[model samples]
Target chain A: MILLDDGCPDFAGEMGEKTGIDFNRCLQCKTCANGCPFIDGMDQAPNRIIRMIQFGMAEEVLKTSTIWVCVGCNTCSSACPMAIDIPALMDGLRHAALDRGVEIPEPDILNFHQEVLNTVKKYGRTHKLEIMMRYKLKKMDLFSDMGVGLKMLKKRKLDLTPSRVKDMKAIEKIFQEP
Target chain B: MKRSSRNLDPGPSSGKLKFSFFPGCSLKASGHENTLSLLKFCQSMDIDLVELEDWNCCGSSSAHSIDKRSAKYLPMRNLSLAPRGVPLLIACPSCLLRLKSSFLSIKADPALRRDYEDFFEKPFDDELEIIHFFEIFNRVDLKDHMEILAGTLKGIRVAPYYGCMLFMPPDLRYEKSHTGIIEKSLKSLGADIVSYGYANRCCGTYLSVAKPDIARKVVNEIIFKAMEAGAECLVTACSMCHLNLEIRCTLDNPIPVLHFSELLSMALGAEDHKKWFPRHIVDPVPLLKKRGLLA
Candidate 1:
């Protein structure tokens, strides 16, 4: 009861070759989807994403919130009977999505990712207080986790100052390369 | 146990099992309690955990999702800095997975290895063994030590939560069975092991911060499942799992969440327990006090 799409481009093969995920081996059993914690929040389930890739539906796959929302928890990959590295494949898809300049459905998550990198780039290590402050300012939800933040501060869990690595240039170099 | 042929002794000789410790970002920050407890526990075990010189971020989930190159390169840089023979001891499961996966990726592709060397301006020898601290604990014979500490944790029912990262992608995991080492360690410490269905379940991770509603639903399920199984406390190896469960769970009567290292330290009779336990959002001391583990 499935229609053949011989004309479709081979997104699965490209992604598989890049990440060694073997998307073709996916059985459509929905095991990965069933085990996924965020399946309900995802626009397409993990298995559906794999199926879309197999059918070479790159644009649709890239446009969905599935890749953005995927936590890279590796639950799906661990449960996959095909032994497909679904988390790595998801990473590859996110890379592809960014490269293709596809619209990211989850802008806040995207912003958070960039901000984390930026925080690390600036401090060589992540300063939780600074990162949280910047993230809140960007997201404009400064009060969301303020209670927990206060608790962390009182416990001396949050370092007031940033940790600087001796070789800041080396960290900068890693960020600059490619 | 072949020592590194290289003469690079980065830290003072402790005449013990030496490892370059990569605490990752969380350990230095929100997971400070885990760091303090782990350090104290290691000191007691006589393991010399030298901090990796100029260690940078592992990029965690952010770099991996955004750029494949950064994901591999960030951890690769840390691996390159590690001494030739000493295994790298990573406390955070996220860092362990990233470092191990990156090591495997470079090993599988010579071209990628060459590119990394050229890019980092350092030799890309995949000789460094990346070992998680949990694995290190597993190797240590805690049986003798347990006898002394057994009284502290006796009769306390606990659930061991192994979260998703510690047992995933086969090659990177410490054990095939998710809770094997943890369960063994808990039993050795004289605690009642509560069998829970969601022991290896994901705690919704970063989503707990980015999307709390979704994470709360998952966190609630994990907590309720443990409580339903009669577990008085939940101990986890991953800091993110600890954070999610402690912060996100919307339970009226939430159980205490403790890092395995903290529990181990307590059993080993770590004094000034206030230093580590206070950092927890849901205080674990009340439960420990109720169990007669703490004064």
Candidate 2:
């Protein structure tokens, strides 16, 4: 029920840390995992994570790489017989873990997501160069993608200067607001 | 939601053919040509396009990825603002899905529907139907009108690219069968149409910023698929798809990407092809010139 509510924007009148979670209805079907193409890379498949939640194994659920790897593609949500919005729950779980300052299974992946957010927050949209600079400055090895980036730059596909949306502060407010 | 008289204003025009235009962010930004050409076509076709007032972004697939309700509400606010009982013409597939998904969910829940009504200035009557601009173009008899362009694009072959957004989530209801019609439209303008496997491939969308490495890999696949299928040029209905596949890629095997409108506009000789064509990261200018259409 909480998952359904959180997924529906009409009920977002009051924002809170508990974005919402509805875990009671999962039937232990492996369909979400079976249907997921990214399942092989995940430590806990969607079904196993749901089972972990059902078993009150919050620590296991929170710590697993499953939440980070979730593409939020709605494949799991679509395949779930219970029609559980597993993608949204996974997003919620990710936020839950982040709020608690838990280290992600792959720090680089989390850093990448955060880099995007920071870029968008700063310029309202990202420029390839700015993103690369931030990534390299934060951790050096990320510059390895530059071989490809330089090639694209020569072709004028990757602009060195980042573009900004007009009134970026308003755009920033949209992201910063609850 | 209380239905106010202002929200009930039957809009500036009335007929069996009226559509509220929801130009997604791309249309306002880089994809402005698609929107302009679409409006021009609508004008020529006598279809009244009512623009929604004070509309914000539909949040595209981003808001939905982070929060489902934000996705629904983001689109719902726009849907509620539209004139009731008119089919909404969506240019962006992402926006169409966001609106349609919210609409379907609202009908399934009474409390939520009622709560939505209370929040909006006008009560949403569940009367708004989402339709794509492409659907309108193909459904209407534009054959005679398109025939005028038969001599314009003499020898260019276009592969119609739908990308992933236009076909996914099962609810957008785009007729995959329209491939023939799209081909016919281009051919009517005197361009040869090619078949390609990348017609429905993913373009790494927001991931272009979110995960550049993954995005590059995904975009490479789409490009390779298009080239492998023997398409000389690629045409798309979505601006973001065009931007991603044609503009954002790091690939060397770049093909010209044309918005369906730009292609049609070129055929009509109504487009300033130089302004639009060269701006693309992968210039389609050479392709047009090859066909002697870019003199």
Candidate 3:
């Protein structure tokens, strides 16, 4: 019982303006959908998502797991006949979803993103062990990758100590601005 | 202003080519081998890789997904700190993509450039070249060195995995296929380059963490494709790709995955191959020993 035209706003135009990718140039050739590795899991193929955006289906586009599932591999952008920056467009949608406070379908994915940012914000560089631990705690999936984590630790690949950059205040300021 | 790869000068005419090195996060953590091998390779070639002074995170995939401005500014901070006139050489392809895209984005828009300058308190210079470490192979004449090391890599059939970031969004890519330089270098080292279908395929990246099933599927396909083409090992430039290929590979017999730099350094007679090979999830030592590349 989803109404495509009832509350659909000019999502595509705003997104295009924000990301600088002209959705109008998409040839509907399915090249992007064909090349997407996650298309099978997607509710709508990438090409269809673009078409939905073009049709101003803001709610449908925003609510779908498409944005969250996209790994930002840039395969679609490379395959696009029109050379549209589809990966950038995907990033813009993720940002827009955050701005609108849309509930991301994949909470773990959302948590992972936030955890990575929090680690970077605190240390000014990503601490692999800290980031992974925080992400697991946030997602409460502690035991899933424990074995591999232990292996990484044993190999000394995941250092326990966090790297400290000199300009902590500057990094904090950059996060504060805009 | 599109920078053509051809216009890039090959090698440093001077005694040493000095540049700031940004190893990103993975280089210090999961991809320590890449850092070790790259440093060894640089030392052998008389290249000076001064580590960037107190470099911060480039925001990577996370910042770009949540906040657009932070994504641009975080990497911009690193670019700003990079020494003027000295190109910034980055080992991770993901870092290169973030830095290069931010550079292009700011250059395309003036107000955005002003905002970055105001935030960073430093003038944004578009002239600064962000070079990927793989591109350095293209610049150096490795023919003679390869001849010297040819015996080591003889009979090693390798599949060069370019992953996705090395060539994408048209401009950031060093070359269209992005595997030519790697393949050429491996060939020069006397290794057989296997023609595989998924050479440029996505390694499912962070998706391996977010969605393991999807990641496993993609990694399996790449692995099988390489094995089908008779490759004993998979050589890649990106750290993430190396991680994904190794971690998600559910193959019955997984092939050894080595960063292209690892193989290059090993071929160049790096004394401490043992230091880096242990870092690999899929041990490459057995294959190397079998081929008599390692004693």
Per lDDT, the best of the predicted structures is: 3
User: Is candidate 2 or 3 superior in DockQ?
Assistant: 3
lDDT tens per residue, model 3, B1-295: 1122234334557544676899899887788888888888887775677788888889988898987667878998988898788889988888988888788878888998998888778898888988888667666666646656765688799999988877675556543344588888788778899997888798988877778888899999999999999999999988878888887888897999999889888888898988898888889999999988888
Q: Write the per-residue lDDT of candidate 1 for residues B177-231, one digit (tens) a residue.
A: 4347878887877889999889888898778767888999999999999999999
Relative to the unseen true structure, what is the Cα RMSD of model 3? 5.0
lDDT (10s digit) by residue, model 3, range A90-115: 88888888889887887877888888
Alpha-carbon interface RMSD for all candidates, in angstroms: 1.5, 5.0, 1.4
* C-alpha lDDT of residue B105 in model 3: 73
Model 1 spans > 4 angstroms off:
A1-7, B1-15, B170-178
lDDT of 1 at B81: 85
Chain A TM-score per model, please list them. 0.90, 0.79, 0.90
Which consecutive 10 residues in model 3 chain B have the weakest lDDT in total?
B1-10
DockQ of each: 0.70, 0.14, 0.70
Note the residue pairs that clash in candidate 3: none
Provide the global lDDT of candidate 1 against the true structure.
0.81
Pairs with backbone N, CA or C atoms under 3 Å apart (clashes), candidate 2: A7-B68, A7-B69, A8-B69, A9-B69, B1-B117, B1-B118
lDDT of predicted model 2: 0.64
Interface RMSD of 2: 5.0
Q: Please identify which of the two predictions, 1 or 2, would achieve the higher TM-score against the true structure.
A: 1
